[model samples]
Target: MTVNRRFTLAARPQGLPKDSDFLLTQDIVPPLQEGEFLIRNHYASIDPAIRGWLEPGGNYMPPVPIGDAVRASTIGVVELSRHPDFTAGQWVMGLNKVEDYSIGRGDGFTQPIDVDAVPSPTAYLSVAGAVGLTAWFGVEDVMQPAAGQTVLVSGAAGAVGSLVGQLAKRRGARVVGIAGGAEKCARLIDRYGFDQAIDYRGKDVEALSADIAAACPDGVHFVYENVGGACLDAALLNLAQGALVVICGLISEYNSAPQGARNIWQLLVKTATMRGYLISQYLDRFPEGVTAMAKLAGEGAIVYDEHVEDGIDNALPAMLRLFDGSNQGKMILKLI
Candidate 1:
């Protein structure tokens, strides 16, 4: 008999997540029925959005429901198949949660990738998969920045934030990035061609707002927000009359008790559209986003980064760091 290891949501957290919140265990796998296949997971994604899902209330993504293996994106290879669509040895990625193996019908996943096209199997979860696609679509669908307009991206040093800024630059937007430190800020501009980078660590919101205003003399035309809190407010204070505010994420607010939106009145004053988006709504456009992002990545127009930790034992601790600004880029667990 085959066995599977999984991470279950053991406890709901108050602020930031802790290792105790997760419970890891193994179970015997049952025989596959018709139209079913078994996958050996290669990697699992750790994202800020996962923090929002752990809440015990109404979030756009359904709550994990205590005692269930947490929901996540995983990349793996087919090990056993009773279905014709999924063949053994083929690599695949989709919503596989955090299990070492999954038994599911073929309809839930994309066709497996050619190992020759992408050098790493993990690239599927990073670039062509959910992370990169989210960044690509956020730039096109939400920002739509025009030539000479300024697009401000918070969490600008991160995987999604970095891509969003560069893509905006391709469209001729003056790109200003807000990252946590001097090192991250340098990487944003020096490495990724961001027009200007602001280090938000220990900076006052009013001062930060002034700097952003100075960097963008015409006021910001688009705020591709990823970090919420005072950084979000700073961006809010300097918006142009008709700017689009892409509410891609709110990493700062994830650990706060009873998460709330602040400085919302700025929306009405600037006549700005402040919209919250979830990737599930954009599933229909996944391929288009994937193609464009892959093209940019391949052409050197977009930069990609991943902070990989080895083994499932580190998954809980590694994910806890995201809320603390400890992660350098997209966080992934490399499972053997």
Candidate 2:
């Protein structure tokens, strides 16, 4: 019998998730039934959103029961199939438990992957994946940032943040990124073509606020918020009238040891519409999101800077990089 190794949730995390919060075990892959197909996983995405799933309360879906494998999106190739819809050579992405092999019912799943369109499977986990879709939907359907407007993106060097900033840039808006280091800031401006990038590492909030004001002379008309808390306060200092603030994910508050984001009034005075969006809400518009992102990617209009960790064993370290502000772009695990 073939065995599939998976990462199971045991004890919920208190603040920053520890490796001990996960329990790794192997289970036998049962034989496929009438319409089932067996898949061998290729890559798994490790995102900041996964931290929310570890919490005891407040989740888009139900919490992962103790001893259950954590819920995640995985890309894999069909190794064997009894299903008529799926073939042995076709590639697919599905919501499956973290493991070496998964079974698909050939239902709402079985999203096809085009190997000719993209170079690597990593894209399926990044821009083609949920994070990429999040950037597209948030930028278009949610924020709708326009030309000549100024947009600020927090955690601008991260997976979703990098893509968000570039989308704003592609729309003819002045893009400013908030990153942690000079290197990341340089990559944001030089590599990603952001108009300017602010390094928040050891920098005062007022200084960052001033820097943002300097970069965005007209003021920030649109904000793609990722890192919340103090960064949120900084973005607040330079708000344009009727600004659209799209909240996709919050990496800052996920592992809060203490309180964060002292200022909340910026939204009120500037008449800014700060809204949080969950991807589940945009299920119907996913194809549109995919088309937009892929088209941009195909034309070299979107910048996808991936910070890759090659192996499932590096999942813990790679995921923690988000909270630590160390990752340069979308972090993905390359399972060999």
By TM-score, who's the top model here? 1
lDDT for position 155 in model 1: 93
Candidate 1: where is the Cα deviation over 4 Å? 108-111, 258-261
> How many clashes (backbone atoms < 3 Å, residues ≥3 apart in a chain or on different chains) does model 1 have?
0
Per-candidate TM-scores read: 0.95, 0.93
Give the per-residue lDDT of model 1 (tens digit) for 1-336: 877788888999878788788899788888999988888888989888888889997377789978888888888899999998889988877787788887757664455765455546676677667878887778787667888788999999887888888788888878999999889999998888998998888888888888888888888888888888878888988989977888888888788853445677888998988877767778778767766766666666667788898888888877887877778878898877
Give, for candidate 1, the lowest lDDT window spanning 10 residues: 108-117
Clashes of each: 0, 0
- lDDT per residue for candidate 2 within 204-243, as digits (tens), equals 7788888888888888898788887778878887889888
Off by over 4 Å in 2: 106-110, 257-260
| Position 235, candidate 1: lDDT | 90
In lDDT terms, how accurate is model 2? 0.80
In candidate 1, position 289 carries an lDDT of 74
